[model samples]
Target: MSVAARIAGPDLHETSVAPRSRSRMLALVIALAFAAVGGQLVRLAWQNEDASTIRVSMMSSPANTLARPDIVDRNGRLLATDVQMPSLYADPLLIQDADEAAERLVRLFPQIDVRELRQSLADKSRRFVWVRRGLSPAMAQRVHNLGIPGLLFVDEIRRTYPAGRLGGHILGRVDIDNRGTGGIERYIDEIGASEAAVGARLSARAPVRLSLDLGVMHALDEELAGAMVRYEAAGAAGLVMDVLTGEVVASVSRPGVDPAVYEDALDPSRIDRIAAGTYELGSIMKLVTVAMALEMGRSLDSMVDTAEPLKAGRFTIEDLHPLGRPMSVSEVFIHSSNVGAGQLALSAGAATQKAFLQKLGLWSALKTEVSSGPAPQKPQQIGRIEQITLSFGHGLATTPLQFAAASAALMNGGTRVTPTFMALDGEAPVVRGERVVSARTSALLREVMRRNVTDPAGTGRRADVPGFEVGGKTGTAEMAAKGGYRKKSVLASFIGTFPSSEPRYVTLILLFEPKGQDVTGGEITAGRNAAPTTARIIERIAPLLGVPAKSL
Candidate 1:
């Protein structure tokens, strides 16, 4: 490295040299380490922002805010972190000519309004006008060479998501001040993890480890993105959660937003569909309905009348394919019989159905570290139509995150689950939440859920992963338009629990506005799209989660 290059970071104002006595040795070792990896560092903080190139400018503001602690995945992979970057600011009084300065700066940063910059520079009264914040090393060097008077660079701390867009929604974002703005970043601030009072250096505080496994998150993202392409879907979302602890191991929504890109977070299309947005979720909700029936003294084999369509005032409740005969409750779930589910709901009465849903925590909003999930939109009054439609996952809307949590509870021996994004250490107290249903009910639901996948004619048979014992349900609901549901545009979804005999994880996958492509035999149903997508994810992620595959 050149003497002058070592003296500065990228190209910024030179400062009194920071001690290089031991840093040179550290830099040499890092270079050797990078060389071992073919010059591609997997960006684990110090490894990426090489000590050889970066020099923290000895500049401080009156209030030099904290260098936020590093964020890592469950397996100690870097996610979000603070790296020293030079932020450009200006002192209006020092600028020689406002017009010239603005014109010169605008050449480097076209995004900066030349008129506004000129006015700010001309104002002699104002001192510390921010020219720009969070400039890359090369970009900072280009701006520094501009030699515009009054332009100054400070060694400000900036938050960076090194994993790029992977786990972006959950990693959250920070402000120009490195303060948490949204997602887990905001959660850190709420919990007082960002103690900025310490000097502006890397936080000595322990890295905030999240429950997200980078490997599992990457698998989930790749599969969901691929599903969108293969099925010609408008959007897709998926997540994997530990049924026992409600720890979300992997959650993804596409097209995903990069936390580093400020404007990407603002785009409506790029919203985190798993947690931030709510939908009717279609028939996967029948899992709750089935669980409720089991809790209400009904056995899986109990017969439910399904010979004719059930009426709820103006709307008639009918199955996609009616059996035209009484059917066992187990068959009802496997076939995804809307008429059977409605009959069960009617038999339980609206009050019972409403209370059962409340017990499962499906009626209210579910709050996690990432978001305060929007409350499910349900009928103002629990009339007959509302009761029947809700049983079949209509007339109610909920965040996929919330629905996943409820599903986890039913599979996890009926305990109420509170989903968390934080990694739970082995020593961390694992207190089981309140029981939502009897263990017997949970066992029966798990059995039925498994049967739904294993049954030859089951709606969810396509989701089966050999040796993984995948048990799941499929839902294909018409997307609601302004007036009524659009039959052509459907939301395909599947919810699965793996190693069904003893589920360790619950997975939920949703595909919005999927088209009837030739691959699906020109059908936009969850059985054809979402179910198979779930199988692909479970196949890849089961090994990552350390779940051994049993001989089928």
Candidate 2:
């Protein structure tokens, strides 16, 4: 009886243990299944986060674009902005007939090279290939209607110029990948104002505010365009700069490049003339000569014998409109007497003349947010002939921008003025550059400039705007050829300052290779073309610049 009971008890215990083990195994399997599912979900979440924070290296791929800050004028008018645009792409591996696709695409865009696209699509190894970037909605829809397999669209940020060609030279262009190429666009890159983006994410940073006054810019462009037609000029350029702050309020070059069309900017003939081209600026340089004399302890009444032409080597320096008499320092400036300027420069000698030019920032390269101005082309040797030619601005060639900066210093109470395309943070920093001339000398120069325009016989009389008290000097410089200067193809320029009593803005107007026209009285001189053009510009832009007109 005992043996049988023991055997039965062992069997029951074994059965109970087997059922418990099975239950434990089932629980472990369920736990492992849930763990695997939970891990999969976590991995998917991690992948999404990684995608969102992915950093694209722009240097590695040209297709990787940048997110740039908005560019706005001082008045908050939009100049340039990044807009979302649809871009066409192809999965080369999935494309069935590359040749057919290329042919169809060419029908939609005549600009697309069929052969090149066919080659790009034939590369089945490439997963993605760009067909076209920045397509308009209509073009995108047409491509979509084709229902071509493997053709896809991706949203991309594209640079857009809302002002059209108004401030094109200053606003600059971006490449196909939205990278800054020139002008203030390059400055934005240098200042870390742009972000590299993998996709179509927009920039959320504050807009970059420029010193340009849109109203004034448009006014200047209109005036220059009209002058180009009125004077029959090959080209024209104009700029307005704050005399005290060095801020360039408005700048324009006719035959301007539209920033939206990058190809136009690449054209050599459409380059920015204000800062990119250098020229012998002619008689306007007499202002520098006069300033040098004043700094050398000569007063406005100081007289220079200008009765004869100045001879240096084989070159003779004579006034275009000679007074044929001894000229006072004031008269020399007003008359733009090349003979008197040469004599004054001879008195100062070469070293002093160069020093004065350097101090006025006319002898070196100038840089602003828009560009590093083309370096000044100074005479290699400052000998007698060189000095004479330089006195009237022929031997030394400089960009109009550099010349305008020097003129600004002369009118801003003897303090040096630097030109800038970006707006000042607040009040302009007090100019700390070394004083080039005495305040008294600056005032005297102002008086002479005013007289040059106010006098009925003054060359710049045509530049005068009533109530605005405009004053300026005229310059006509022949373009330098392979060996010498062209006789007829001259660069006519006029630099004007307003309200001579208290100067604010300085304007520079230039006409390149102008021809005789009825409006210009059949003359190509600066007084006939550039001076009157400046007058028109001032009349329109003065009110926009907030310059109050004096009561008649």
Clash-forming residue pairs, model 1: none
Candidate 1, which segments miss by more than 4 Å at Cα?
1-59, 197-199
Residue 400 C-alpha lDDT in model 2: 87
Task: Give the alpha carbon lDDT tens digit for every residue of 1-552 in model 1.
Answer: 456566556444333343464477789999998787863554555475565334433233445576678999999999988887878889999988999988988988999999998999999999989989878999989987887778898776778888999998888898877788899999999998887743346777899999999999999999998999999999999999999898999999999989999999999999999998989988998988888889899999999999999997887888878889999999999999999989888889999999988887788998889888778888899988888899999989988988999999999998988999999986878789999899999999999999998889999999999999999999988888999999899999999999999999999999999998898999999999999999999999999999999986
User: What does each candidate score in C-alpha RMSD?
Assistant: 16.7, 5.5
Clash count of each predicted structure: 0, 0
Best by TM-score: 2
**C-alpha RMSD between model 2 and the true structure:** 5.5
Residues 1-552, candidate 2: write the lDDT tens digits: 334544566575466566567678789999999999999999999798666545443322334789999999998999999998999999999899999999999999999889999999999989999899999999899999998899999889999998999989988888888899898999999999999876787899899999999999988999898888887889999999999888899989889999998688889999888988888899999988988998888988989999999988887777778878899998888878889999999999999999888888888888888887888888888999988888988888888888888998899888888788888776645555567678988998899899999888788999988899998999998999999889889999999999788899999999999999887778899999999989999998888888999998
Whole-model lDDT per candidate: 0.89, 0.88
Candidate 2 segments whose C-alpha is farther than 4 A from its true place? 1-63, 427-433
State in Å the error of residue 497, model 2: 0.4
Q: In candidate 2, how many Å is residue 287 off?
A: 0.8
